[model samples]
Target: MRWIEAWTKIQTLFIPGVAGLREVVQGTRTTHPSDQLQCPQDFPLLLPSLILHSVSYDRTLEEIKWKLHEGQAHNALNELCQVLQSRAYMLKFKDSFL
Candidate 1:
């Protein structure tokens, strides 16, 4: 499915750096000398970008929390399953090339 493909791409391209950033921000991880050479510590623009991303992540999480509170989690999951099944059916139909 397209959504799954997109999620996989994000996991491959974006997740590792974010995880590293999180560790750096939390003071739990340090970059090796060679790693610093690749993404120098003195990069002036990095802080603002990291802050923006952190805020965006926080806002998204808050929205999901409220949405879950408004709807029963089980109902939300059932709706998701229905959507995925419908999309799968459409994909299969298209693949049939009729």
Candidate 2:
């Protein structure tokens, strides 16, 4: 359920048009009339910002997993705490925007 909610929010942010978020992220333009969704030009940083955030989260999780696999439970726990703190800060920041 949480995964579904997260994915839905991602889809909402990068609402796909005929051109798709991938094309916009790559700085490509499509000539199709239906290619315009949320006016990517108006929010040029949105897709890349989301992509970067997602990548950072994934990398952090992978590092934590690797640490655990190596029996470095203490380091993994510390990293997890830091990630939670970062997430809390982000949530507060997002709420400020709202």
Candidate 3:
């Protein structure tokens, strides 16, 4: 259930950027404006690909390629979400100094 909450939070984090999101939900374009957005330098590249793979294993390679093209946007948000979920699982000690 915590994971569901975490995922919900992740979704909310992205709620404000529906301009690019609208294009996706409406299936009007294969490409998105957020595709041009930049991934944070501190974020690892492999993480997003892994998240994308896990969440959408059935997706075609072309679709994955489109989703991860510029290493930004929803891909990054999804990656960060998986990371957050993992950390939340360790909530008992997430802030412990020991």
CA RMSD for every model?
A: 13.4, 17.5, 18.7
Once all C-alphas are superposed, what RMSD does model 2 give against the true structure? Answer: 17.5
* Most TM-score-accurate candidate: 1
lDDT of 1 by residue, 1-98 (tens): 45544554563353344445544553433345443423334332223234555533435545665787778877888999999999999999999976
Q: Write the per-residue lDDT of candidate 3 for residues 6-55, one digit (tens) a residue.
A: 65456445333423343454354325775542444422222234445333
Q: What lDDT would each prediction earn against the true structure? A: 0.54, 0.55, 0.50
Task: Supply candidate 1's per-residue lDDT for 75.
Answer: 89
lDDT of model 1 at residue 56?
A: 32
Q: State how far residue 92 of model 3 sits from its true place (Å).
A: 4.1
Off by over 4 Å in 3: 1-71, 92-98
| Two-way TM-score contest, 1 vs 3, winner | 1
Query: What is residue 36's positional error in candidate 3, in angstroms?
Result: 32
Candidate maximizing lDDT: 2
**Model 2's lDDT to the true fold?**
0.55
Per-model TM-score on C-alpha atoms:
0.28, 0.27, 0.23
Model 1 residue 58 CA deviation (Å) reads 32
Error of 3 at 51 (Å): 36
Candidate 2 lDDT for residue 79: 97
